[model samples]
Target: MKRLSVSLSAIALIAAIPLLGGTPVLASLQKAGESIVQTLTRPQVKLNLGAEKQVVAQDQSGKEQVSWKSLEGNAVVQPGNILRYTVSSENAGDVPAKNLTVTQPIPQQMAYVLGSATNSNGAKMTYSIDNGKNFVENPTIQVKLANGKVETRPAPAEAYTHVRWRFGKSIDPTTGVKAAYEVKVK
Candidate 1:
């Protein structure tokens, strides 16, 4: 049917943040002793992203089963429909990539599913409620109590504006890492 152009430039932006590190590797130059040549070796990560729509069905036993259909093709979704977004990354460079991070923004018309964010690389997960400027493990909001007192409480799912995952370890060359999260159409 129809092909959608889904861009994931955020991954590239995050990957490039750690470019300045050790000195470049030395290479052979002309005349074998004239001058030393420097070659920059760094991690070049590639990312692939996909979106799927969740479908629920009942079998003969009347048990509910969930299935996902790729959103790459012509797909129509209604309000309250669940959609899962997955991003896969692989390093193709000579050196390992350190402190890998991925941030995903929640659509204005969608509500994030709490506890639905997952990473295959054992990353530290954080949430952002104010666009993407700030992030915390659990975003909180101050609510005024009945007695003219204000208390801080965990922000609701609808308040989630972004989700971020930070990997503690370095990703080796050709290693694949995946992250996913679910959101519901508002």
Candidate 2:
């Protein structure tokens, strides 16, 4: 999945925006033994992203098991293969980073697996069908019925263009979170 790499640094910068308030500002002063000093700082979050291919193995009894193989270092990806992408973030600063959101764009020629997105940090997940322009918890589309009436229905997996996870709680110092989703190569 080398070809499917995302700009994780860019995402980290975006996640830091809310805390930076457009630019770094003087935060507060700390009193230490009759001395007061002003400290300017912001949350520093380290972000990482990786891709893996799902493998299904069968035993002699025909029992199926699932596993993932890292897609790094020249791994070959082919059509109809199922791939899982994981995004991880850790706060390395003293301050807690609030309102952290991670958005990952679906790689071209891949179809999302519905309901496959998961977050370990208890985040509110959303989907985008218009190339990340807009996102909703459940994306729907208008469909025309045989009776010439229009109906609203859940969007198809192929229509999914991006996945986003927004965390309600602040990420404390030295703590981390993870989010993952699956997609099928088209």
Candidate 3:
């Protein structure tokens, strides 16, 4: 009789789900679900490289004006041509994501454009010259002259190996973030 009463009580508790007022029986299950969701917060990131082609077209005023068309995907490029690299990150999970950092490697055959990197999400930007071994606001290297004099000089865009973006705030759920920079083909 006691076992039967205990079984009935368990069944009653399991069936007692209220939409307006939650009961103590569902608290454990609710917390477990929340913890699992928080632990599974995943962020998706993607990168794209493109070039802008100028087209001469007549405006409404009948004057020839230059307009740009973005060319993406595998396309033939030439030296001294400008290209844009964009990095996009999004929160694909139900929870917020923190400390999102996106890194891009500047191809050896290309030179990064100085003062062209910008962040739309207000992320902190840094550069690396030692193959991404170290990152800083401005990278420098020690130069040795013929007289054995050592001097530290700022690294040029051609010397840049990588670019990094450290997000300043947490990325909210379903929020999309983008950052981009320009470079020139060698």
Candidate 4:
């Protein structure tokens, strides 16, 4: 009778696997769903740099006017020319992307234009002067004085190392946000 009781308990425990909703099969199914979601919902970002061009435009006045144009594709830039760098972020997934942030390094041998950074789609912009080690709305640096004292001053345009944009809201699927900043080639 004791052996029969032990056998019945073992059978009952085996039957409880599915009934308790804690079986390995259910766990694997949950993992599969998570994998599908992760694979389906991902953010895609595209970055580009363009040079500004001065174009001559002729209107009905029979006179030519100089206009600024953005040379976007395969642009050729020279020293002392202004270049605009843009970042476009799009959510390719079926769901919204949360906490979307885009960062771009300042091109070497270039100087960032003060207050030229702009953000679309309700984003916040920040600057970093320490090779992306830190970010702030107005980046500054510490200068050590000869008297053994340090003073913080506004960072120069040439000191900018990176720019970042942080989105406050979620980015909807198939929707994109654009951010840009201007820099002068050294």
Ranking by lDDT: 2, 1, 4, 3
Off by over 4 Å in 4: 1-22, 41-74, 145-149
What is the TM-score of each predicted model, taking all chains together?
0.78, 0.78, 0.68, 0.71
Candidate 2's TM-score reads 0.78
lDDT per residue for candidate 3 within 1-186, as digits (tens), equals: 999999999888777646225656478778899997767765543344445644568999999996656876776778877777777766776767778888899989999999888887899999998999999998888999999999999888899989999997888887868888878889
The collision pairs in model 3 are none
Off by over 4 Å in 1: 1-40
Note the Cα lDDT for every prediction shown: 0.88, 0.90, 0.80, 0.82
Reference-based lDDT, residue 51, model 4: 51
The Cα error of candidate 2 at residue 178, in Å, is 0.2
For model 4, residues 1-186, the per-residue Cα lDDT tens digits are: 999999999999999877668768788898999998887766544344445654557989889986667786686777877777667766766778788888888988889999988888878899999999999999888999999999999999999999999998988878878898888889
Q: lDDT: which is higher, 2 or 3?
A: 2
Q: Lowest-lDDT window of 10 residues in candidate 2?
A: 29-38
Which tens-of-lDDT digit does each residue in 74-168 have in candidate 1? 77889999999998999997889999998999999999999999999899999999999999998999999999999999999999999999999
How well is each residue in 93-160 modelled by candidate 2, as lDDT tens digits? 87898999999999889999999999998999999999999999999999999999999999999999
- Model 1 misses residue 183 by how many Å? 0.3
Model 3 Cα displacement at 120 (Å)? 0.9
Candidate 1 lowest-lDDT run of ten: 20-29
Model 4 clash pairs are none
